[model samples]
Target: MNQQPLSIPADTQASLLDVLREQLHLTGTKKGCDHEQCGACTVHIDGQTALSSLTIAHMVTDKKITTIEGLAMGEQIHPMQEGFIA
Candidate 1:
């Protein structure tokens, strides 16, 4: 895993969804309802579920953000994800 920490502004007003998609180029997190009505933009913030559409980019600077790309370890899928697949 080549996980590297991203340094972003602590006062950025951009949404987490935009940061993930446009900045980081992580397109796995889709943009559904920007109002958080749909769950398409769900992500894990410090191991907790969060709606990326509504999350502020600055608010997550001090926290770990896990997207769908981070869900697996090489060829080994996470057990929770395996369960869902089953």
Candidate 2:
């Protein structure tokens, strides 16, 4: 398969968790085990909770991958995040 250049931020670490936390700066997604044992790195892939670490970076090509980053609009927080905080 031809590899496409995924536009993850330059400063992001190579790991999937690191990319989400550092580049996108979505700190809500925790990192309990880098081994993908714990469910802390859970995220919705095409509307299903998936272990982001197990997914290849290129697999998300042109697809809407919802991270903790894109959960909120300009000034609003996602209900899920707010519920956790509350």
Runs in model 1 lying further than 4 Å from the true structure: 9-11, 78-86
Candidate 2, residues 1-86: lDDT per residue as tens digits? 01223476433325555666776676777887767698778777667777777666556656556766567767898897786689
Checking candidate 1 for backbone clashes, the offending pairs are none
Using Cα atoms with residue i matched to residue i, what is each candidate's TM-score against the true structure?
0.79, 0.62
Candidate 2 residues lying further than 4 Å off, grouped into runs, are 1-6, 9-13, 35-37
Task: Give the count of colliding residue pairs in each prediction.
Answer: 0, 0
